[model samples]
Target: MKVLIPSFYLILFLLISNCSTNETVIEDVTEIESVYFPTVDGTNWETKSINSLNWNESQLQPLLDYLEEKNTKGFIVLHDGKIVIENYFNNHDIESNWYWASAGKTLTTAISGIAQHENLININNKVSDYLGTGWTSASIEKEQLITCENLLSMTTGLDDSIGDSVLPENLQYVTDAGERWAYHNVYVKMQDVITQASNQSWSNYFNTKLRDRIGMTGAWIPFSDLSVYWSNTRSMARFGLLMSANGKWETSQIIPENFINEATSTSQDINRAYGYLWWLNGKNTYHLPQSQLEFNGELIPNAPSDMFAALGKNDQKTYIVPSKKLVIVRMGEAADNSNFALSTFDNDLWEKINLLID
Candidate 1:
């Protein structure tokens, strides 16, 4: 009788242990899946205090000071879709509008993904399929070789030296498509492709498909041949939050998860640090804008290895780190020496950020 009683208790103990283990696994999954989303039409975004996160509050001021000295107009750090830090410097306020510069290319990438999902476009198709022929100075054969994916990956083989204009006269062929990676403005043609395929103006399509759906308030204003997106700082954070949630807002998959995975990963062999119009860190090697030189090591050495960013001229940035569940945004003028996309400022800024967040 005593031996049977001991065995029964042992089995009961094992069952409870297994049940506890299952509960722990469920809790971890729930934590990972949990995320906050701000209301689309109202200014009701949620925030998490630094104290709540147990972050180093002492390092906050120094980071803000460094940002101000570097000409930053607005800065925001989001953790799991909740605002952790929001600050504006250089006479810039929350209400002020700022241009995204080349950072807006990621927006085009997302919209292009949506177009593809809806069967309105295909990245594998030739750009001529949507825009017709003679879009560039390349021969029909060379031009046909340029797929919409080439534009997304910045491998159009177009002459970037001619400048940012997308006019055929300026988009002369440099080499075969996918032969090289150059950060040219030819990616803008994807916007035109979306326009052509959707039968709607670029802004109209962008507004209805992405901007409005995600509660982002912005407009693509024309600057010469370039169409730059401009929005307030919070709007930028909202977009980042959406991205941090793996292209979802609440229940709706605003951008396909599979597309987001591909867009954030290395897109081509030429530039290991580039995704679909997004700048990636933690790559073994990377190429920069307007230069063919491939630099060794990660794009931003101090940032998290999993970090990917949308970097723009004059230091506009939207850095998203998946492992850390963070989305950081910065907007304003040049940090130093008016550079395009990346600069020394990125490394220095991440140094200060590490102090506060780590």
Candidate 2:
């Protein structure tokens, strides 16, 4: 009986020792850092291979094939600030320029932040301060109530039924500012306000404040009264990387950190899924463009809960996922006949992306 009792105690000791060892091993594995911030100069960028990250190459090819079948012009995925996967289809290459469509709204939002940082413009100030009275068809009283923040949040109370144009005639007030949310051309008017307020042309202000600092090459082309930005696919990726780095390029702070936080968080009460001009995921509710209906879920359910995206017409996208340290950019024709901004393609693409990473 004495021998048996000693044997039982020995077994119990081994079991306790094994349990403690397993716990320590698990903690060590979790402690390893997952994110890497790449060095940035004027133009050079570092890259990492999928194999190095232990990403599933077998699934990557299938994702690329799907992008090709969907008419994707360019696709890039950055992990830990380094390019992990970049593919071009339809004879498009790294040098080909593509339009950002409405996705460029995020760029405008970022530039506005930079301008505000320099004290050249204030988003809380009335738009009339820069554009002056009689700028809109609304009465002077109603127009005075519209601030730059209203434009950024798509709550300018403008009639969105008209065509999307920056002309004063198109900016007819349908309701008092701060009482409604409608995505319309009034956002373009913000360009004029910025230009007038900063005493610089729109291109000059944007280039000097943002594009040149980050080594991004792009041009704002006039299109039917809208200033759409065009850049190479890599340029889009660079912008995404900068955003993922919290509006910093290497050691320099490009956009103020406070603005970056506000721009990625909910900007208005009406749309919990929208921040400034960016679309936020994992929100309880969302409002789609050109529609007053509210959806009850995250903007892109397949994407990471913390992901925010700059969506554009015909599926152009630049997604920044901070939790994963990921930045994904896609420039392509319409994946489906959907709205100008949010559509089923966003979820579909993220679905494929999840599969590749998993």
Candidate 3:
């Protein structure tokens, strides 16, 4: 018995020592120095403080931080009214360009709104009026009804079967017109309508009226993974701020309230989603029927009803939640299945944010 006692004591002491070495106390974890939020700026976060907790000169937390640290292309956050979070990854400074993916549609929507503001075109006008005959083979009335609004709202009834890839143009727009809610890249390509109607290229018009006026210096023109119009991260954040402020730039009403409401709001074709070039949560607003959406589940798993987003493939997003008076931008790799890569960044970051606020 005496021999067994010493052996048991030795084993217990070793076990306790290992546990003490491995365990990280919560209080110690909570005291993490400044949290750095990610951004499109292409750098680690600069820290800022709200009340009790410190905000990563950008944004700091587990989930958000991890996202930015690994595989994060860029991220920007607008709280209340100012940009409080901007971070970039991989030696890719704020200068590194990113593919907006489908989020580019939101840019198209803004351009179309500008055209309407200038009186160059009306939303009710038929696409055929600009693209000419055979843009659609549907009935004359349906063709006429396929207006600029239809393109923005994703409501021309065009489906994925006859997607944007098939729409007609110069190696552009395809055959089918009205069917489902496929990508309507053709609608934005119709920026030609704006230029023809307003007499300027889309880039020139936006630069003169939007970018320059707002003191923005990044490229805002069109771009693709295969194109030359690469956009730096800062430019994208500027656009998010513009939307957060309801189309206003600095102190000017660059985007009219009516147009902002109409553009950011929902449409008639898609469900819980499918706003002309935009996406809505479809929880409450009476835009379209929830059952009309392509996805079976809710637009976002736990996104607030008032939350709307400009989403792109591979997890690029510009989330706008008016109730929270917040705009959160996230550009990253496909964040779906790769937990081992960067899941905790955002999770950890969000946990800290909760501590800062209520």
Most accurate candidate by lDDT: 1
Candidate 3 per-residue lDDT over residues 1-358, each given as its tens digit: 1222356776686678678857632222123232222333334324333432343324345545566545777877666545566677765677677767666667777877777887878877887777775665455655665777767765565443443343342222223344444454455645666777877877788778776665455554434312123466666666776787788754567877688888766565434455667776634422222223354544553555666677665556777777766677776676655331112333344344544343
lDDT of each: 0.91, 0.86, 0.59
Ranked by lDDT, top first = 1, 2, 3
Which segments of candidate 1 are over 4 A away from where they belong? 1-33
Question: Residue by residue across 1-358, what tens digits does model 2's lDDT show?
Answer: 1222356786686678787846422122124454444433435567889888777788988899899998899999998778888899999998899999999999989988888998888999999999889888999999999999999989999899888776888889888998887877688777888899888899998988888887788799988878899999988988898889888876788999999999999988898998899999999999888889998988888999999999999999999988878899999888868558988888998889988777
Worst 10 residues of 2 by lDDT: 23-32
Collision count of model 1: 0
Model 2, runs deviating above 4 Å? 1-43
lDDT of 1 by residue, 1-358 (tens): 1223356786686678787845422121122248989899957988899998888999999999999999999999998888899999988998899999989999999999999999999999999999999999999999999999999999999899987789999999999999999999999999999999999999999999999998888788989998899999988888888888888999999999999999999999989999999999999999998899989999999999999999989999999999888999999999998888999999999999999988
- Using TM-score as the measure, the top candidate is 1
Return the number of clashes found in candidate 2.
0
lDDT, candidate 3, equals: 0.59
Per-candidate clashes, comma-separated: 0, 0, 44
The residue ranges of model 3 lying beyond 4 angstroms of the native Cα positions read: 1-48, 52-59, 136-142, 162-179, 220-229, 282-297, 337-358
